[model samples]
Target: MKLEPVIGLEIHVQLKTKSKMFCGCSNRGEFEAPNATICPVCTGQPGVLPVINKEAIKMGVLASLALNCKINEHSKFDRKHYFYPDLPKGYQISQFDLPVGEKGFLEIDVPTKEGIRTARVGITRLHMEEDAAKNTHSDDKTATLVDYNRGGTPLAEIVSEPDIKSPQEAKIFLQELRKIMRYLGVSDADMEKGQLRCDANISMREYVEGAAPDENWAIQLNPKTEIKNINSFRAVERALEYEIARQTKHWEETGSPNTVQATRGWDDTKGVTTEQRTKEGSSDYRYFPEPDLPPMELVEIRDKQKEMLPELPRARKYRFMDQYGFSMADAEILTDDPYKAEYTERALSELVSWLLSLPEIEGTETEIWDNYGEKMAKLYSGWFINKLGGIMAQNAIDIRILKITPENFAEFITLVYENKISGPNALKLLELMIGAGGDPSQLLDEHDLGAMKEDKDEMDKIIEKVINEHQVAVSDYKAGKQTAIMFLIGQVMKESKGKANPETAKEMLIEKLEK
Candidate 1:
């Protein structure tokens, strides 16, 4: 019998706020000394009362709305009792029955062999909670150290339903979710820094070929193995894939699915999931409503957060495609980072305005945009995403600190579009501008890199020199070897020291060769 993997994810996002969730201690303690941000409330001293972070609550509401979750008007904290070194109070303050949001869905674009398809994954809940302290174990396995600096940090736990069918879908879902968080200014969602973490619950079920699972699929689901220690989205995908294969092999060997639910840890270096412990049910935590903290009234909070919502990634992506004529792939890359997206829009706006003001270009604003918007957009994206992006990567420059302003970038792109400078000279001018910002037109003149096309006499002299120097290629072109003209054009460009425009040189070479 063939088996299909059923998967769910538990994502914990560290909220970007001023202080810890229930205390006034600093929240920026990840890079600080151990226990530097700890206080009585966060470290669980005797008789310390917990106060909720209003900013954290506001961010939670914003994220919930972005995820299309229904916010609970009445929600309160609960005490989750579990004994661990990381838990100083012996219980964690989290939401139980009354979470901040629930019954939400996130749409992910899944790539298939044929094409891309949208898949909606159901969200079970997004609850507010406090993070545990950091734990460091000795290499000898004889001692363990706990750092309370990260303790009591605000966290939003997002639990997804078992709607994910494959590992690739799970990875895409996480990436989209992270983009939403970053767009909302809720969290950085950097997986390597532990700002965003994931745990996967996966199980294998026997299924018929070419048939969808029915409502009774849950009843038929074999006991799931909860895989933890998934530090990154790639790890989440790899762990789920490994667990599915392991469970499928067990089913084959034992003639039945594994009956016991368990927990496993992913060893990224080894590319394997090692058994950690048996999974615990909800009752094991002994959850109860906290007595100190009062229940929240969210009607006012929801309204305020809704007003503060910015344009999300998906909407921005569609707008880029419809308005700028950018392809889906290019739009996705452009909108992935909010800062980068804003920069692109501003630069494009400048370019469009400049294009419309040119005296030689004939047409109304709408007609001009319709005629040249796509062509200009393609040129801009190629230079921005491919050329400039590669240069930034090489020099370790973030878009935030980029020396080239959007206006300057727009000017540079216009230079390329108008062919004011040759392609090679344009690249050199761009690198110069990126290092020490300046106007593209002025820089072109300052560097003596203007295209030779405007100098018709000089271009004619260079073309004539190339035809005379490459007699064999000239003879080849005259004798019906039309491809030899490309060689002649290369000689013209080289003879002109990369100042000659290739198109003009090709036209001049063909004109002279035909004569």
Candidate 2:
């Protein structure tokens, strides 16, 4: 019998707040020495009261809004009773019934055999809680140590419904969620640094055999095995994929009746999951509302957080397509990050200003900009997203800290547009500008990087010489081989030491070769 896989995810994102959730300790514990950033409240010292961090709450609410969740007006923390070496309090302060947000949905695009398909995943809830401390195991297998520095860090635990149908979908869901968090400045969501964590619940059910023709069919689900400690997106997808195949094989071998629901941990290096222990139900936690903190009233800050929310990736994507006429792929790349998108827009605005100030103008500024804007936007998008993006990735550069100002970038694009520099030379100039700050024009002059022989008279001489030397290509062109003209243009550019403008060279080559 064929079976279908069911999967859901619980994601914990550490908020990028200044302090911990319930204590004054620094939340920036990723780089801190083990246990150095902890305080009495975080370490669970008796008689020390835990105070909630307001910034954490604000970030949680912002994340909820970004996820399209409904904000709960009154939400409070509960004590989750558990025993672990890392939990100094013997329990975690978390939300049980009334979480910060609920009843939300996230849409993801997945690739299939046919094409790209859009699916909506239901978000069950988004709750706030404190993170557990870090546990480290010595390589010698002699000791296990606990570091409380990560404890009390604020986390927004987002639970998604079992709507993801495949491992690919699960990966996309996490990627989109991470992108949203990064856009909101809520969290870095870097899995490598342990800022983002995920637990996946996966199960398989036999495809239903018979149902009424018009009735919606529902299959009975098998007991789910929850996989834990999946750090990265690739791990999440790989673990789930492995679990699905393993569970399916188990069902085939022993039947579903003998399969037991359990908790498992991914051995990333081993490429398999190992059983951790039996899965615990809600009652095992014995959750109780914390009497120390009162129910939070979020009405006052809800509107303020909404006002602070910037245009998210999805919305900005459509706007980029509508306003700039960018393709979906191009828009997606340009708007992947908030800062990159902002930089693109800023440079585009500066570019339009430069275009409007040009000497030739037969119409209103709006009309003029409209006529040339799409072409210019395409040019800017290509250079920024492809050329500059590659350079940044190669050099481990962050746009936020990059030396090239958007204004300078706009000037660089203007140079390319005006043919003051060839494409090859423009790339070289961009590299120099990124390494050291200077006016693009001044750099062009200082480095002698201007286009070579743009004057038709000089270009004609170069093209004539190329045509004379490349007799076979000239004969091919005269014999109606249109593509042969490119060969002549290549020779002209090579002779000019790559300073020759390609478009001008091509035109000159055509003029001389046709004759």
Candidate 3:
């Protein structure tokens, strides 16, 4: 029997707010000493009342808008009963049926051998909730420790429908979702820091070959295994892949597709999932409206948040491609970080202005862009993404802390575009500008790194000297060895200390050698 994996994800995003969801405790508990940020309300002391954090609600609404979720005009918090060492109150305050948002979807682009395939994963609901405290177990398994400081931290639980088809789709969905959250300025959504976490529910459904699951009436839903403790996006993909294989093997061995629903923990080290416990149903939680907090009227808040929504990642990516003539790959990278995207746009604008001011170029703004947009855009992306990005990575520098301003970056790119400096000299000038924060032109002059191509007479003399010194290479070129000219050009650049443009030297060397 042919089988397919049905997958859904429940993502919990910790909102970047100043205080806990139901109290005034500092929300920066992840950085503080354990239990330092806890207070009576968040720690669930008896006789203490809980006050909702308005800022957290605003952020939740903003995120929902970004996700294209329809906001619920009215919503309420419920007490989710559970017993755990990390739960100080013996219950969690979360949304039940009436969540903050619902019926949204996230679009992801999956690359295949054929081309880019776009998939829209449906979002079931996004609810407001409080986070559980951190649990630490001893190495010997003798004792456990709890840190209540993280308790009551504001969280947005985004539940997705079983729309994900494969493990790669799941990973891409999560990545796109994280980018949206970051673009909204609501949260960093850093998986390593525990701000954004995912629990995936996956099951295998038997299907006929070449038949759609929806069209096949014989297809039945198998019990799903909810995989938890997924720390990273890669782990989510790997864990789902492992589970699909394990379940497929079980079906073949037992000759039965029916299995008990369970919750499992992903062991990243062993690359397998271990059964944690049987999965609990909603009824098991005994969810009831919270008595301490009143129901919320979110219509006003939703309207206000809608007005505050910024351009999302997907929209910005498309805009970058359409406006700047950037390739899809380049646009994705440029728009992945909001700060980097802004920097790229500003630098491109400066480049356009500088190009228009050039004496040799004469055209309307649109005409000029239509003529040179793609070429200039490609040049800028190569330097920004490959060259400059590599340098920043080598120095362990974040784009936010980059010392090179967009204007200066544009000027440097202009120098390269106009062939004012050779490639090697351009690289050296860029490094200097990055280190000392000087103008590209000034750095070029100070370091004597200007391209030697502008001085035609001086370049001719250098080419003559290189031809005389490399008699063997000159003979090879004269004897129809086409690649020997490259060696002569290398000597010219070396003799000129990398100031000579290779293209100019190649032309001069070929002319001199042919003569």
TM-score winner among the candidates?
3
lDDT of 1 by residue, 379-475 (tens): 9999999999999999999999998999999999988888888888888999999999888888889989987758889988888888888899998
lDDT, each prediction = 0.91, 0.87, 0.90
* Ranked candidates, highest lDDT first: 1, 3, 2
Instruction: Give the C-alpha miss distance for residue 324 in model 2, angstroms.
Output: 0.7
Tell me the alpha-carbon RMSD of every candidate.
Answer: 2.4, 3.0, 2.2
Which candidate leads in lDDT? Answer: 1
Candidate 1: the clashing residue pairs are none
Error of 3 at 500 (Å): 1.2
Backbone clash numbers for all candidates listed: 0, 0, 0
Off by over 4 Å in 2: 112-116, 208-220, 359-370, 464-490, 507-515
Report how far residue 154 has shifted in candidate 3, in Å: 0.5
Q: Residue 457 of model 1: what lDDT?
A: 91
TM-score of each: 0.94, 0.91, 0.95
Model 3 whole-model lDDT (C-alpha atoms):
0.90
Candidate 3 stretches with Cα past 4 Å from truth are 212-219, 464-488, 510-515
